[model samples]
Target: LIVCTHDLAVTLTQRPHHLIEYLARMKKRVTFLHLRHLYEQPRDKGSPYIRKKVKIGGVEVRAIFAPFPSPLLNIFRGLCVLLHVLLFDKHRYRVGINQGDPWIGFVFYILRAIGVIERYVYEDLDYNPGGHKNWLFKRITEIAEYYSIKVSDLVICVSLNLLRLRNRWRINRVIYSPNGVHLSLFSRAIKKKAHPPTILYIGSITEYFGLDIAISVLPSLLKKIPEIRLIIAGSGYYLDDLKRIINKYPEIKGHIIFLGRIPHEKIPDLMAESDIGLAIFPPSELMHYACPIKIFEYMAAGLSIITTRGTEAARILKKYSVGLIINYSVENLKEAILKLFMDGCLYKRFSMNSLKFSVKHDWNKIFHDEFKEIESLYLEYVLIHKRTVS
Candidate 1:
């Protein structure tokens, strides 16, 4: 059973979606409880819990719509989960996974404590305690996370820096796992010559993410190589900021392609056509811990990476001998882009290295390393969900 804070079908995702697919392939039954986003809740203020399946085409969801934001949202979610526990067999799930939000972890901890779930794994994708702006909510999440960590059987951290808190308390059962890519999906995506020397920046558009820096270097890059193209995909809180940059430099509009919030499936196709993948995030202590899924996906598709200096992405690239890393400046970015274009051997070496790096980091291998037949170990107990759930 998987309990996620966000809708798997609707959000700009990576981790939870991959987990669901991985579990299904192992022939384990999935019982999904999707807590809809605040905006997705019912407008009839009183009638907020609109429960049903979203378009998770293959997974069977015993859906329960969570109402709009309230201090008791987590409590309401816990009640819905409890209802499911009462409706179905009490010990229906052998293993339970909680994705996102520390509050959800409290529910899983309770489930584990009472033997409702045999094992509880808390996958901490972003291990940031100060991520929430609200002071009260931040403290509440810290308390909940502290409780969850104490109770969970395993705590998976996506990046190395996530180990800091665990180290402080000597905790972090510490699964140092990174994000992965569906290699077969990239294999099936037909690569076409979309344009001349294209650089792709496909991810949630944000201020510190360096989309503006990519735009700023374009005119200078175009001076040397006229056909240099920039493809910017994905939308976020920083879309308005990026648009302001684009508006200020209207001449670069024709040189750039904006494919706002591309579907998850279509990302591989974009990766295939792209020559360079830009992950130019600025310097930040918090960002150093980030394991950007796009970087792994870029490697899977054999796209040369150009990441900022001293980031996890840069470290991964340098470790694999895949791509270039430089300071966060327009000139440095333009030079890196040009260098890949000018040096054939260097470009080929980077591309080959990326492909080789991807083989080991494929979703299958990563999950296998992390799970190690734990699914099969529990499969015998889950022969049939004999108890029906409403």
Candidate 2:
């Protein structure tokens, strides 16, 4: 069973899509419980439970939806889960995978204590203890995180830096599983037109993502390369602020285009049409340890990457010669963009290297390797438990 914070129907990005698709392909029996808050009130006000049967990769999957707005809703959802476990799960479930949701982890811990679940895995993709604006809320969530980490049989993290928490948390088993991309989907031939060179920025439009810096450097870039254009995709809380900043610079407005939140399927085509990919993130603890999915997707699409320094993705770029890393400043970014645009050989080399590096980091390979480790650990635990019982 996989429990996550987003509904699979609304968005299939990040952890939810990757794990569900991989499990379906492996022909494993998987049930996904989506505990997401609905923007509008659910139609069934009496019963805020919704169920769906969906198919991914031709494999049938059971999806359950529950409202997760408050503590009361979470308690109700826990009861729903307990009922499902007792009535439907006749064969005891061997593993439960919870995606950093403390409430879900608490419920699974209860199930494990009752012998319904043998063990549970905690997947932590992001380590943002101080991300919430509400200090009380942040502290509560952090406590929940600690509890989840303590109770989990196996902890899976997307960054190696997170392994440092093993010693701090007294955890025995931790695995580093970085983000990956679907190579085949992004294997379209790069466009070979003599039009204006396009620099593309995809994913969320948040302040920390450094899209504002990209916008700030565009005026300087336009002067050097008159035909260069900037394309910004995706939407977030900072979208209006970004638009306001752009409005201040009417001269470069024609050179910049904003494509609000794009569908996941259309990203590949958009990448293929562009010359460069921007993976800039602000210099912060959270970003320094992050394995951004956009970086891998850019590589798979064969775009030369321009990213901020000190990130895990930047380390991979440096090791593989797949992209250029610059200081998180407007001047440095402007200089790097101009250098890449002016030098044809350097751009070609990085573009080719990006594609070559992506072959090793495909989603298929990363998940297969992690799954093997998980199985081995489970088997070892079973053997030890039997010996102890005897």
Candidate 3:
């Protein structure tokens, strides 16, 4: 069973895609339990718990949706989840794979203790506590995460930094599984044109994502390279705030374009149209451990990048010479953009290196390599359990 806090159909995003692909490749019979509001089909107005069957890449999948909407209602959601498992899922699932939802971990822990779940794996992709503003909520989240890490049989972290943090929990197994890109999706050869240079920023427009920093550097960038354009894509809580910020800067009005929330399939064409990619995450504990998927996508699309220092992805960018890493400041960002814009040969070299580095970090290769070792252990456990039962 694969458990996630986000809706599997609508907001699965990149990390979940990797997990789904892994399950499909391993040909594992799996049930996906989503414990969140139904964002994709908000008008359903049906039962709180909905069940359906779906197929992905010829793999059969059973999906169950249980809406919890808010963390304050976790107790109710936990009851709903426990009831569903006891009524329909008991003795049917061998392992439970949770995708880093601390709140939902409570139910999984209980299921494991009661023999309903034989094994549990917790996949921690991000440090989410830094994003929560309410002190009570943050404390609750921290406690839940601590218990989740302490109780899981295996812990999979997305970065070395995260793995190191989890080591303090004395977990039985902790594996580093970084974010990866779908190389084939962005491998199309794009012809370079002599039109105005464009810088692209694709991801959520959240305050911590540093979209404002990108906007702050636009005026200076336009002054250095008048033909330069900034294309801001993706939508989030800060969309209207970003628009207001852009409106404040009259000089950059015509030079900036906003393409709100581009579909995942159309991102490659958007990448092909741009010369540079911006991936600036503000300095925060949450971002320090982040391996942004956008960085890998930028590399896969063969675009030079400008990212803030101290992130796990920035280390890879710096190591491969695929992009520039600078401080999270407007001045540093402006300088980096100007330098890349002024040096055509350097940009081309970085672009080539980006593509070269991305090939080794493709999602298919990463999952195959990591899961080969993991599945062996899982199979042994399954065989042992079968023998004991028989």
Candidate 4:
């Protein structure tokens, strides 16, 4: 099989290591890899990890990492254009993924010209519109939706919210593959931590994630348990606002720690060090059907969770007895945190249950099942297209 994917499996970003490992394991059957933009650069401060060449199942993979080029140099950009112009094959199976407009447009023309393209799969991992309030994300997402729905043979979404997003856009043939974690990677903890515990909030501190709620409830929580501290371990647009809130609360000024944007690999260590994991999102269209990966990560860490009620993520938490589920209010949130401070047996139960529950939803099992299903469907679609053309 020949796989055509975009910048998705970029190294050191979005768990590309896991995908590379999985694909390399399948080399006994795979013929070629048609990848576009296989690597991604960090937002600033350069590449996230040290570059290395490692063999996965003895298969050497080619990586193309340049997204933008310095006009003075321009060599990488020039090479990318050259690859777009020159790469070709007449009889191999084709799978066009979320490659940018240029690559997708070129593949559509080439596949139609030679007429051997089997299936076109559009996989959307980031379907959150509120993720970026900027113009760049909006414009690119709009164009991606246009071509992805207009030309793909199958559309795959990593979350159920994305499937609903497809239907809203009037795109059919959507499949849901919810984001998952590797249960084995999680540190199994038999004993739970003591009361007046340390609380943790991971990921972005943006408006969409409701960092305000976390900040507002803190003063009250501190009055109740002065020993408590809320450690925020990520950075985003709302970082400044969150900092201001912390500054305003003089009693708990030092109690709030901001560890700006640490490496993703270091997140597990941070979680393991903390006693409670926190996720608080306000009500919105996006939040309604969303299933956050943080919830699973918190569970994998075996930390008792505190989250908003009524959302899909909360419902999942409620089912698993993972942690306290409360509505989006300062009083309610303060109460929930107090319960953990006051009740030891409840925290222990939640901590134990969360780790045990997360085992069934590991990424290895989830992705393996997804890949097999997609491969089968894609193959059948190819055969049907061939017969119809004949």
The prediction achieving the highest TM-score against the true structure is 3
Q: Tell me model 3's lDDT, rounded to 2 decimals.
A: 0.77
For model 2, what is the error of residue 333's alpha carbon versus the real structure, in angstroms, after optimal superposition? 1.2
Give the Cα-based TM-score of candidate 2 against the true structure: 0.88
Candidate 2 vs candidate 4: which has greater lDDT? Answer: 2
TM-score per model over all chains:
0.84, 0.88, 0.89, 0.74
lDDT of 2 by residue, 1-390 (tens): 666665554442676677777887887776666654546432222221234655565444554446655643654655555566677667566777787666566778988898777788888777655355566766776776788788888888887766676557888778888889888777863554455789999886788789888888888887888888989887667989888889888878899989876667778888867888998888776687677898889988888999888777788789889778999999999888888988999999999998888988889888898888878877887999899999
Sorted by lDDT (best first), the order is 3, 2, 1, 4
Q: List the residue pairs that clash in candidate 4.
A: none
| Whole-model Cα lDDT of every candidate shown, in order | 0.74, 0.76, 0.77, 0.63
Residue 26's lDDT in candidate 1: 70
**Which candidate has the highest lDDT of all?**
3
Model 3 TM-score, 2 decimals: 0.89
Clashes of each: 0, 0, 0, 0
Tens digits of per-residue lDDT for model 3, 322-367: 9899999999998898889889899999999988888877898787
Model 4 per-residue lDDT at 20: 52
Better of 1 and 2 by lDDT: 2
After superposition on all CA atoms, what RMSD does each candidate show versus the true structure?
5.9, 4.0, 3.5, 5.5
lDDT of 4: 0.63
